[model samples]
Target chain A: MNFDDAVRLTEILLGFAFAQQSIEHFKSFPNEQRLFIPRFVLAVLLMIGFQTAWVAGLLFLSGLAMLHRFQGPYNGGSDRMSLLVLFCLCLVYLAPTQRWQEIAFGYLALQLVFSYFFSGWVKIVNPEWRSGRALCDVFQFSVYPASESLRQWSKSPRVLFVMAWGVMVFELIFPLLLLSRISLVIALIVAAGFHFANACLFGLNRFFWIWISAYPSILWFQLRFITAN
Target chain B: MFHILKLLLPAVIPSWRFFDVIAPSPRIQFALLNSANAPSDNDYEWCEFRPRPAHLSFLQMLGRMFWNPERNESLFLVSCAERIVQQPTQHSEDEILKRIIAELKTNHSDSTGETTHLQFRLLLVQRQDSRLQQQVVFHSRIQSLSTQDKT
Candidate 1:
């Protein structure tokens, strides 16, 4: 994908994610609900590619206001990723030159890679996660389970162990996939499926949309930098 | 200036470490109090507020990606409870306490009219030795249910 195509796809995906998130905020306090109107409007403007630099800047500011309202991210990783994507988009559109835009966009791709790598690195170092105890505990006791029935997965220790290792290995090796276009495509597909399963099991629907929104940038980064090199 | 920076730090600096360590999850429980400032005997049983549903269909799960207000609100409550556990400040406690009271009033409208006061506690749930254990971490002082809440 070219840089412009990547930016457009990112905008569309982010627009949908932001719109969904805005609707979720309607269930919050009146002040919080008020913020969603402008957010939804900005998201629509972003998806339509109308005055993108201005839309991105306002959206970034709106995101900061939202963080202050919640005193932190309302939803942890997903909110952070959304803010990161907005920040990168702002840089991409507001940059003075195409070369600078590519650099800014590439930085976002780099951060996405680091997000997965760092998550895996932390888990691998923790004894609980390494032994599969963390996954077991998560399924057994975490408040995130979508339903009580989903917790049944905790009963199988062997399955949990293999799943734990599978996640760790995939995340640790994620950066290597960028070396080839086909490998990157396959890696992104697996990552999407992983997010889908988490959404189904934990009801972390926001993570799936926000993370997928950033995938186009990763594809563009691999094609432009990794393949070119 | 320092307070502003403190608020901005979380938004500006992203923490990607997710589920790296599975810690005990917090569950909020509430009990109704009688006019005597004590738990009413019949209403003494603490009930879990906003528990996850026992089951969800595949289509329901798929639809959650676009709209899931109940689950999002539940997650927000979890985040608030987590903050109270991690940082036991008056502000954090008050924030979540108010939310729980509001939720109880909304969800148990029929029971709220007769309930003059309420109290809530935070339970840290964890699995140990192949069994689930709940440890009470914080007990809130009795809070009055105002006329506004009853209405």
Candidate 2:
């Protein structure tokens, strides 16, 4: 974490993506999720888990309660089992370890790699997806509701062709971009634009934004660890 | 640096501990095995622990089928084998068809296969559907099951 990176982190904690954009965006969007309120509260109460573990435990449990409440009555036994297993896993992570923290960050990177590749795979296998209609279908997902102009543009043969190619190029070789250090920057920038456009255009909920921003940190962590190893 | 990342990106919660040293501004990873997780026990990366080959697990192989069924006909092959083994004598293709259908109706519910019972249940339906292709199991001389059945 360099000086600039430190600045980036402070803004993130303050719910600012970057200084200028954060201010502009914050002013525009007053009522979305506050990026750091809960964490900020937890940090202050627990003093960052340095002095008291209880505060961290309470915060973790409260979050779990909220998540469970949202799911509302598991109809399937399998889903219940999956949730139980997941909860047990989270408990295992709270143990203190310098090394474990490193692994946690690595897992986040793996999530990024897996999600892009898997999502791309899901698109590729579908015939509808291969022909480019899949992109339209995906865009229609509640995440990216196309505006009338965007919808009109989507129908153009040229637009469809470009969309088809873009989907394939972005998804098919997604994993490779992550693996190759030099290419990742390219992958990240394009992917960010993709998500940002989706968010701005369709009001798509991109939890993926937070997920991906964390990626830059992950790669830095991974490189350091590999060198140390 | 660690302190700075924490002081800065609190919502950016590091998902795993793997990047503690290099987290650009402190990082986050999800679904990781580490000491941050307690009660569940596993903390080391799979590479660090056991250090084994990357063979696919049984469930993983089954999941591949859901991607596309035609490519995986193992279920069809097994059904054909079972019919041949159980009623080798019933020759006339019509009689065999009847027998197979009967077997299917009687055994509509699939029995447990290794890890999860659901695999067998899923396979049963697909196998029944494939039987329409009537894939013959090589040369089997059916001498006439009518006489065998009645007399």
Candidate 3:
């Protein structure tokens, strides 16, 4: 898809994904949930293609309320990234010129790239992460285990070490996703697989949706700035 | 100079870690202590802080949906406990203990009931490689709780 189409696709997909969680949040916290219910409805409208830009703005305000009600990010990384994506989308809608829209998406793309690269660097610096002990430890104490079989694998140090290195290497090289269409496709597929594995094992379901939403922006930035040039 | 400063910003800024890093070895658990310098096992069990009442399943689900259900303000809690441990002057200890107890009371208070004089001990448990090498990082009476609470 082209950049604009990609942007539209991202908005609809994110709207649908967040709507479920938003409704769940509304149901969970009766006292602070009032604002989120309206946000949930607006998100569904955004998905249904009703006054997309205006709905996006309302969604942005409600998103801010949700952030405040939680006193910070409720789910950490995914929440923060989701907020950024909403801001970027609103900016794209507000931009007066095509050049400004391109820049806005490019900024989102930069944040996405930095997130992975920065995370990888942090891991490589830590002794525990470097030793592969971190992954083993997480699997051992994960809240929602995929199965007893998966938990048993945490006992094998060699397997954990290999998996740790694999994750670190892939994340470090994640920026290479911007190289070309073929590379970007492959990188995204691999990243999707990684996110799917996390969701299956640890039930980090929110991460999958937020991270996938950024892929379109990354693709747009690469095509507009690097490939097209 | 500008490029170097730009490069270092992410390293300096704290947000980048973003729960991406996993801690190794011993898993950390926090236990709430009562005003008597003992665990408040009357309502909630002393083993761990699992939210009671089956109807609050949504809250439990919300906890699992985000991060570990057991950890809330965990890093800050540990740091405060450590500060009290490192400097055990009567004044400092009293100040920290007062703060912790006040926080617990506020968090657990029910508006419908009369104010209660609740004194509880906070225990920081770290389970090591196996069941044997566990460490008690913090108990209410840091110096005497293990013996006192046991009895």
lDDT of 2 by residue, B6-99 (tens): 3223223322221011101100111122122222213312111111123434354334312212111122223333444445333322233333
Give the CA lDDT, 0 to 100, for residue A198 in model 1: 91
- Find the 10 residues in a row with the least total lDDT in model 2 chain B: B115-124
DockQ of each: 0.57, 0.01, 0.12
Model 2: residues >4 Å from true position, as ranges?
Answer: A1-59, A72-95, A138-143, A225-229, B1-151
Of the candidates numbered 2 and 3, which has the greater TM-score value?
Answer: 3
What is the lDDT, from 0 to 100, of the residue A58 in candidate 1?
90
Worst 10 residues of 1 chain B by lDDT: B142-151
Compared with the true structure, the alpha-carbon lDDT of candidate 1 equals: 0.83
Worst 10 residues of 1 chain A by lDDT: A24-33
DockQ of 1: 0.57
Quote the positional error of residue B51 for candidate 2 in Å.
Answer: 55
lDDT of 2 by residue, A100-135 (tens): 644544554555565456556655666665666545
Question: lDDT at A25 for candidate 2?
Answer: 21
Q: Give the number of the best model, judged by TM-score.
A: 1
